[model samples]
Target: MRENTAEESARLQSAAKDHLWLHFTQHGTYNDDVDIPMIVRGEGINLFDDRGKKYIDGLGGLFTSQVGHGRTELGQAAAEQAAKLEFMPLWSYAHPAAVQLAERIAGYAPGDLNRVFFTNSGSESVETAWKLAKKYFKLTGKPGKHKVISRSTAYHGTTHGALSITGIAGLKQDFEPLVPSTIQVSNTNAYRAKELTAGAIDVTDEQSLERFGLWAADQIALAIENAGPDTVAAVYLEPVQNAGGCFPPPPGYFQRVREICDQYDVLLVSDEVICAFGRLGEMFGATHFDYQPDIITTAKGITSGYSPLGAVIATDRIMEPFLTPGAMFGHGYTFGGHPVSAAVALKNLDIFEEENLLEHVRSNAQTFRSTLEKLLDLPIVGDVRGEGYFYGIELVKDRATKESFTAEESKTLLHGFISNKLFEEGLYCRADDRGDPVIQLSPPLIAGPADFAEIEQILRNVLSQASAKL
Candidate 1:
């Protein structure tokens, strides 16, 4: 590994401090005492900082890098496409790469979800989904159905419509009086089942969990009824809820939600921004969960983070009204389906097939779960829950009582100690305090038992020290 010179490092740090405003980051905290971290390179499932120190890419570059890193094939594909056609809009004109990629995605999507609308990012995809839902309902003569339903502590995106659907209050408080008529119901955080269920039912055993799952699913139905079904256009959900940690759906959760949506004449949208592209050991999370959604909004791993791209895949039923002559959905991102991104995604999907990445993740998921479950021996680890390559280890103040950290404690624990400690110990995962104090892990699909061990060891050390601090 090549190291940076003192002057070069200082210059980079200076430039970052002067102008680089990070997303969802507290920029003011970076001072002389607290220097900014600069990741200069990545290869395989590891990242290198400006100082050339290597750390495992445990979060898969914000749950995006599915094929790991440093694959010249993806780079070459991007370069070739860029050389041929650098930029093009998806407005009125269609490109070959986009058409091929769209057809491929449609083929993979379940049911009649064969129509694809490309977007620039996950947020745009979500925005498009909501807009499409409203427009679709209007054209289908359900014009009153303009509202959306999502889960509490869920994160959709940062845009106006996406942020409106996002269930995290703190994230939307500043941006509020947001796009109106969005409602939030309970999430399937089975670990917190007792609290979520208001102690109405036991959640200790498998049978009880099933009951909890049904109850959670019923909340969406109740929300729809309360809002009046005619006013509810769609329900947006992630197969495994991302914010507030990876909350996987309980058994029959999606199935029940699907039934409720169908009964209410509402759309079920699987927001796979972070769960798609083999992250959950399947092409789409809905496939892994065995439910068919009316629409699937995806991005992140589409190009393995080689480029920015997202798409909303809708079923035939939803696309029927829009197919009429002179009827149109007035939504399109300028770089929605860039040729280079589409090319990179096509190549990324090829890598997924050529490498059998999906099967690999499926075969290794249990081992990954067991490896991370080892952390439960630590007093701070309240729960380790998720599916496929996605998991979240929730930190608590007292494991026996399932007590969580106070806001100040969470701030100090997550940001001051845990986040920095894990990175300093050479692991690039998330110590998120968005909903709860939890360490989120979604390594590259290529990561196996060996990488899991490295992640376990690093997290073990950092979390042990964190527990000691507490």
Candidate 2:
């Protein structure tokens, strides 16, 4: 890729500043002095800016590029499919690409989750899952079971239905009157177990961790009963909750949640928008955790961001009602399963198998974890927790007291300093303040020890400066 000329770079920056609307971004930040970060190209877990400055893709392009970048084959797959059939609506019709892709995903999904409903993005997949849950319940004679239960600080998506299911109050307050009947329960953040569990369990050892897991899982059951179990349709949870900086399920957490869902006849929806397609060293996060969800909502890594696609994979039981003669779910999107997108997804999966991407993640996950854990030695670093190729390094005001930064301080520390500094230091990751302040890292599955070392060095330098500033 050629570097953008100074004039061209300036022109692109001006155009972006004038027209581009970045998601969840404060546009005001880009002023006369600060230019919008313009990424020109990507290859092998690295991104080059318009100015030709190289940086490690520490967040894997928002946790979407599982197979890294610059794979010409995925692009070729899209081109070939488009030449054959560019557009084919899945409404009242079926395409070979969609059908074959669905079958491939079903083969990957655990248990009886064999039915795939395609969408254009993760939010759509989530919205589709909730709708499916409600419709399935109504078909099964439980018309009132339409409510959803999710974890606190867990981010499902941005659409009204998915937003309603999201537990982040800040993200929902702007869009009031969301789809009702959604409830929030405690999440499985073992680092903050004592507080999240209301002092019910302090995670110090395996025994206490299990106790905390049970306590957290029991919260779902409690919410179900409190909301009237018959009125609750499903429970939406990410295998590793992403919004709160990659909070992995504690040991026995999902097992107990599965038992609870089974006991209550509630559908368990595993929202794997960020956890699927080799991110967790498994095709589905449910498989990684040894649990079976009634439905799995996935996107992002399916095509490695070479194209747009998403899916809501449900169990055979969830599909049983709609299979009856003349029965209809009455839900779909225009570009839900675009043939080109499906073709790209199939090629992406082929790459995964051919390269053993899942095994690569599994074999080196510990190295990734231990590499990030080295940051824990810093006083500002409170906790480094996650699984597979994903991880989060929690920043705190004081390590001894576990005191996090206040809202204003967090804004200054994370957004004002850390975010920009990390980029300037040649690493692209998230310095988030969604819950407490933390740095979230989810490099591509192809990343090895060398990549981890580079990430660690960048983080160590920037975080040490952040600590000194505090």
Candidate 3:
């Protein structure tokens, strides 16, 4: 499927408008008649562009294209590990596809997570799990336990120590003097849990949403007793907290946040960088919420995005003070665990175990959540929440007084009209206004139910024409 050329699409949109600089772009919303997006190719869950057009990859590419996107067997397992050992680097050396993909991601991690470390993204596996939780409390002596905690709008990445454990104060207020002792708290947005309990719980009672998930998991034991649990070491979360959208985890939130980080000896971590490998049909969204963390971090679908990788893993009592003998945690990452991104993450986890694809996202996660809760009979769809095949809808204006939308009306309804009307109606998702003006969807855990009825009929005709323009 090649051969589409308007003089090679005006010389690749004139070398991406004279040199592209995208990431988190605004880029003056592209100039010479707005071009940029580009894309080029992809397969299974679709994609294409550069004149070929197609689309429907509805966010899996950002939520790293699971087993989708033209899987030429993960590019022939990165060209047979770049013809056997292409750039090995897990410093002090190691290879054989990064020691068999870190013993197969420590046998699919959970309890006794069994070390791993590697990194290259997911903000260098959350800046190497906050520098291995401040050097595992300075090699087990608790050298004033290097403070950290996280929640509010969540996110956890964009480097500077995962952007000071990111809680989204406008994406770290223009990266301000960061890398300080972090802290944030209160996230389990059980539909804003009665405005985070100011109305003292009862967001439509299921025993007041399990007492608002045990007061949002006792706010990380009240931020480790107001930062004095030996100056706290770690907390960082996200086994389903992506930004402020896909917020799941409420009822008994992460088992009361693993009993308040095991009664405040802190260190829980589990960032899952977009809910780990299966995007929540559990490979580890902390065992799809059964809880047991210590450190997980991860990267966008391991090698599903074919090459770059990331990890952290931990446990085995946080790698027992870096395996003693002349101990060291003085981090690393010159393409951490490279060897062709650990042989394309051990052949993208052997195509998620020969395409069981985590039981095809656990048997179609409740038909992708009742087909996105049938767009909540739209009035700008106040909430649809999320879980497997990760979701989120939010968008409001008054779905019976849930109100929302005014940061200039959610920047004119999610960036001036529902993200260019759901990519000019072909579907590549996410209209995220960071927190509230949601949309999100995370397609391609080999999306089914006819791709969730063509993503709920293109989000019910662009949210019923964005609820008739409010």
Point out where model 1 deviates above 4 Å: none
Give per-model TM-scores. Answer: 0.99, 0.99, 0.39
- lDDT (10s digit) by residue, model 2, range 104-152: 9999999989999999999999999999998998999999999999999
What's the CA RMSD for each of the models? 0.9, 0.8, 18.3
- What is the clash count for each candidate, in the order shown? 0, 0, 0
Where model 2 places Cα greater than 4 Å from the true spot, the runs are: none
lDDT of 1: 0.93
> Which candidate number would show the highest lDDT if scored against the true structure?
1
Position 149, candidate 1: lDDT: 97
User: Per-residue lDDT tens digits of candidate 3, residues 178-291?
Assistant: 988888988888888877778787578677777888888887898789879998888888888878798887777888778777777888888887888888787888887788
lDDT of 3: 0.84
Count of clashes in candidate 3: 0
Clashing pairs in 3: none
Evaluate all candidate structures by whole-model CA lDDT and list the values in order: 0.93, 0.93, 0.84
